[model samples]
Target chain A: MKNNILIAALLFAAFPLLSNTLVVCPDCPVNTIAKGIALANPCDTVLVQSGTYYENNIEINKDLTLIGEGMPVVDGKEQGEIFTVENKYFYIEGFRIQNVGRSYVEDRAGIRIRKSTQFTIRNNEFDEAFFAIYLQNSSKGLIEGNHISAHSLEEANSGNAIHAWYCSYLEIANNVVKGNRDGIYLEFVDNSLIHNNLSQDNIRYGLHFMFSDDDSYYDNEFVDNGAGVAVMYSKNIVMQRNVFRDNWGAASYGLLLKDIFDSEIFHNRFNQNTVGIFMETSNRLKIQQNEFSENGWAVKMSGGNQTNILSKNNFLHNTFNLSVHSAGTDNVFSSNYWSDYAGYDLDKDGVGDVPHRPMKLFSYVVSSTPEAMVLLRSLFIDLLNFSEKVSPIFTPENVIDETPLMTPLPVFGKV
Target chain B: MFKIFKYSFFDLIRSRWTYIYAGFYFLFTLGMLMLSSDLSKVVISSMNVVLILCPLIATMFGVMYYYNSREFTELLLSQPIKRTSIFTGQFLGLATSLSVSLLVGAGIPFLMFGVFGSDQAGNFLVLLFNGVVLSFIFAAISFFIALKNEDKIKGFGLAILVWLLLAVVYDGLLLLGLSWFRDYPLEKASLIASVLNPIDLSRVMLLLKLDISALMSLTGAVYRKFLGSGVGMAISVAVLLIWTIIPTLGIRRVCLRRDF
Candidate 1:
């Protein structure tokens, strides 16, 4: 196996030497990208010069490198898919692809990779694309430094910027996505890493996951989207150092987890979202060291969430710190700093002597009857909450932080 | 009437209670401003104080002033002055003095913080406007209650009751009603109910401006659409005006017919 691996590496090193470079420009003999790809062989390079190419359905079936000089424009004219790759060892970079047409039946994309392995799509710009960079059943691929944007009016008509379906071992990093239906979408995808991406003003979630597992996302900013990031039916996900900000709307949330199990969420900053981190039916999750400031509700836990350990988080000045619909017995909340925790810290141990109950009676009332939220900040409701805090009655009894921090934890580095 | 109004206004302005009220607000606002640098947050905290304190203080002061100056009011009644003008002048004087106390008390600290230059200027102005309106409404209501009740204990008891009812009990009942009839659409019902109560009206109006982000929820969208608009402002202001006018009219009706 060692000899075979050495021979494969040696063949890859020699293959580039035998490859030829094909140029595609307006004045060249090979003018169109389709013509350039058709003339190129395996392990060859197609160098597309800077010019407007009104092309669509450019298929790549060989192991080739397509490099665009000076960021050439590939306008699909709202026609169909562009640069559909079906083979392995493919690489494309530095092209501005735009205007892939929308269809109710077909999922048209700027670059669609299907059943391909060891591919790299880097430094690309996509505008008005229905689906910007789509991967299906592809493995060991890198999607980096791509700027994807679309004016998505509604959920039905718009598509995602980076969509991965049934894919594995993908690295999506340093991309900026805005105004799309979803910034990044993963369905049935596993073992992926998404980082350093800024997704804002999307019509739907910034990042959406469905049935994906073992994926980690960090250092991403999701701002002013319909919602921030949503992970559903996923397991073993690690989300860290992401900033979810200003996602304000009727149903907007910073991070939404549904039916997710064994996930670790830490060091994230949730600021000014309507609902910061909304969890439903998620179990055994470890949430620690996150900072939640000025959100509507710092964390809203719906029914069926169990065994979740939330510790060392800073809940700073959110209107409602926590709203638990039905408290699970095994869920543990410890050592979290609550700005509204009015308990005294005696003995100077850095923890409050009294247990901090994050769930307020008004939040309980609001969860049951949403219209009662209009009474927020009223003197009557303050009295009611105070009385309820003195004795656990309306709000769930189990949703209490046993060791509440006296001051906000210095968890996040910078936001 | 103008002479009486001027006398009462100056008399209350010189009173130590008025100075104490204004001083309390000034110190509280200044302390809040010093505590937090966020002007919007300061405005929100002041909003709660204004909503609760303005009406209560106005109610207490109105009943106390009317009861304390009863002999002087009788001497004025023995003069050639019209009764309507006398009561109307007293009511106007009391409301204006209370409003001045609120404006000076809350306005100075905000001005020291340069609230006019900040983005929270609009919310601050709304806070002051709601406080002033509540003062007028509650003062008029209490004045009318004092005129109707001959007994001092009963008048003070009734005025405090009115304040308690509007400030606290109304919201409790509204919440109970909202939660009870949650199956039905209570948006219009709740809006109308809040509009009917001047305190709730002021609270809702100020809340829509301050906590708009938190209120931008499912039902809050409906509220934001209504209360965040010019029409809603006009309606709330009109309701507050009606709240003030009805009580003043009741005071006038009692002043003309009362045996005192």
Candidate 2:
């Protein structure tokens, strides 16, 4: 690590003195970006001026900076991969890259970083690209302020907007991504920070991570995707202050956690989703101070979830507060404010005197007989739920908030 | 017809049952509101009560009023008033008085609970509107049944039976059919079946607003399009209007044909 830092420091110091500038335009001596790269030496800066460059399969093997002035357009013309960076210490900024060709055999992208470190891809707009920005085994990269979109209607035919695989220490922020298979997907990626991004209208999950650990994502907005976000088989993930909204479908949810461990999800807002938070086999999760409103089901817990603490959240006007498929969960739910709580505070405390149970018998019935959902809000169903509430039957007995707040907890932003 | 309608309306409005029915609803709604702080939930609970109790009460009240007012009807029949006029006036009077009791009973508690200041006001209004419509529909049907049967016991039994069929049995059969045909696309069939039963139709109308997530889970394109659009709401309302008109027209026709 010390040697790597020393080398980076030396290279950083030597870059300004040794680097030369090469201008590329339609009428310039080096007309194309590929030609400019070919003519320039290592550590040089290629300034591509405003022009439509119809090129593809551009490969950079050395450390270089490709800066586009006036937002030059690089139309791949449905050919292939646009920029393939294989060496360390490169920067790509201020370009509009579009129309990377779709391929069934190869995973193509507009900007691909392969085994490269200390790169910055920022201020670029990608339109109709199969994969807007893809990082493979690349570390210490910064992808910021890019607008990425595609017109993909199916998951099989599309790629993610930003896909990181086997990467670490990446900072991805201030990006807007939409209408791809997934807005951002990470696999085997660790120790990354993703914040201040807006991801919406994707064919699949807005932000999806699988087998990725030690990642933190905060202040991001995910809306109207097939499923808002999914964190699967991951550990030690910190999710804070994000907004998940309008993700409505039978199988969709605001956030899905499967096999996740030791994660912290706090201060998020889940609004109008079919299911707000779905957990399966997730353990030791701390979920606090979130606001869930107008969802079909606020929180659904399946089997194998243990030691999860749900604290101080406000659940407002959801159809079913909690639906648990498991017989019991070793989870602690305390101090949450439930709008459906009917208990009184006789002692004049702010909290209710009686413990409030969020799980309902009708939710368990719906879990087993999904078609019975049509009978929701019916008199018979109401009677069933009332009887079940009067007597502890059908629903799990342990899933109760001991200290239910009488009033809704103040949300993050308003406070 | 107008003068007779006014007299009958005032006569029933002063009756003991009207105050009792209205008072029952007022007290129930007030208790529900006081017990539960969630106004939306109270609205839902009231909806169920309105959906079930409204029809049952309307049926019993319709039969009782028609039977008890037989002397008044015979006295009116001896006058120069038309047969259709007398029956239609009494039917309208009974329907309007029951509806007024329902509206005032439910509305006063909701208003007292500050429901008008909340977003749930719309849902509450729909619930009351549905209650009024159900009252009219069940009363008209019971009036027609009483007109057909001279025996008071038979007419009352048949009226209650009709209520039972629509309120509970129809939904049971609908659910059975849906499950039996679970493999097939049952969206259009389910919607049509619901439209056939006035009770189911009203329940679905409420469900469209209250539990849309659960409704949308049934993967039927036509069902989604119909319920998700304004056109579907218009169609459901039209169907309900047609339901009320048909039973009322039947009452008129039976009254004109029957011999006292």
Candidate 3:
């Protein structure tokens, strides 16, 4: 009788020490997710079963693990933000959140993380979210394997997917963001790694950066967006092994770098964009080993870009290879392969004997007067380009590839 | 008219120059098909060649056939056929023969490469249609020029000069005009200017069908709004028809009033 009483006392003492899992279902006592989270302890797990829960403003304010079983639908019913996480050490996985309402005043998101750190938002599906996976002043977050999509009509009325502001050390990988205003927007963010994300068909830029520095994005694809990727007012950016394709429009480009300094863009494939890479006031960029094919303009540099090196790149079949409006000094174009290079190498070297001038007279004229594009493929323009190419007259004389490769470089193997 | 058309068509088809033109196209198209694996790329490359070569060859053939067959044409003029019918039949014969040579020559290689089974079938059809229409338009214009001038050197010179004006000088002047009116909206003006010339018209039409229209739309929203709609296509087709009709009417008017 004494031993039995002591065992009961021990069992009673160990009960609160163990972490409890509260299951939330339609027929359960704890029906709603909010109730389950409310009744759980700080480190407890809230397991939500498969059902459509029409709820909004599900606030999470403690260290908790929210796991959805069989991918439960958390429908916001177009009300407002769905999951507002404001605490640290939180984890959410495998929930289908949808229909956070559009508001002109507030940026409604499916999952809004405010002042949170060390959070993992993984494998969630979001549909019609105004701004999906919004993180403000958050750090050390892992946002992986999320499918965020929205049917954004215009830039004014829509918001971005995976918007991170004032965040650092973010690992945003394996996310498919489509049809949003801007997929993967980062403003005032630093030291983040974004990889293997397919951001396409967004109304605005696929991946956008403003005042973000020391970010490296690789193996990401930006396809058919409004303008592909735009990195503006940033420094020390490393972009490698990304693809920018089919982002075609009046003011579209594969990559737009404005006021960006000390960036490296290498091993990227830019195909079928209006302008492959448009640099404005960007300096000290090392662009190398890229394959630019079938773009309208491969690289269009304008406005005081200095000390940029474009070497060992392959430019094939673009309408206009390079168009430099005001040519910057020390902008080197060396050892690149140009498909339009007609110079031969009599000495049996791989490099051509004559230097190649990629800027055409017609492109120069069209730059000054865009209306002249109506005569794009005219014989007169071809004659003028040929005449100008034979002798450097209108184009900047400093912009020339001295050692153009005779054959195209093998850029596909690295990718 | 049918007899005259048959006679002229058979006579031209029997000539060595017709065979040579057809053979040239066949060899060139086959070479392009063999060289490039991409159908759309081949279509674009062939568009460049067709845009330049179709009008030039049609113009040359029209003037050369008129000059070479002067004796036979004079013999036919003595017959009891209506003047409009004779000239119209001759014009149709020349245009049809040229189109046939283009069709059989370029079409054979495209068919061999399975263009009909490819996604570029629509673009290929547009290309051939542009080629045929260009042949008819240029042939009618050159025939009109040839009939107006009795001097062989003057007629050939005038025909060649007309080709140069439409093919080269018109674009230069258009460029100059566009640059001069840089601050103003020139999309409509440029569209009108291009439609005025059949070569530029055909080139624009083919460009719209190709992927390069993306680049062209960068000029202005007016270009995008106009060329991105069915109304633009209808207007282009109507203008092409007008281009074909007005010159053929000129040919008929000159044939009737002139003293053969």
Q: Please give the DockQ score of every candidate, comma-separated.
A: 0.63, 0.26, 0.64
On lDDT, who's better, 1 or 2?
Answer: 1
Each model's RMSD to truth, in Å?
3.0, 5.8, 3.1
As a whole number from 0 to 100, the lDDT of residue A325 in candidate 2 is 85
Which lDDT values do the candidates have, in the order given?
Answer: 0.92, 0.89, 0.91
Q: Largest lDDT belongs to which candidate?
A: 1
How well does candidate 2 score on lDDT at residue A87? 86
After superposing candidate 2 on the true structure, give the runs of residues whose Cα lies further than 4 Å from its correct spot. A1-17, A411-415, B1-71, B80-85, B88-135, B145-196, B209-216, B219-222, B225-259
In CAPRI terms, where does candidate 3 land? medium
Model 2: per-residue Cα lDDT over A52-104, one tens digit each: 99999999999999999999999999888999989877899999999997888
- In model 2 chain A, where is the ten-residue run with the lowest total lDDT? A368-377
Model 3 chain B: lowest-lDDT 10 consecutive positions? B218-227
Please give, for residues A195-314, the per-residue lDDT of candidate 1 as tens digits. Answer: 999999999999999999999999999999988999999999999999999998778999999999999998999999999999999999999999999999999999999999999999
- Lowest lDDT 10-residue stretch of candidate 2 chain B: B213-222
True contacts kept of each: 0.62, 0.16, 0.72
Clashes of each: 0, 0, 0
Candidates, ranked, DockQ: 3, 1, 2
User: Which structure is stronger by DockQ: 1 or 3?
Assistant: 3
TM-scores for all predictions: 0.95, 0.82, 0.96
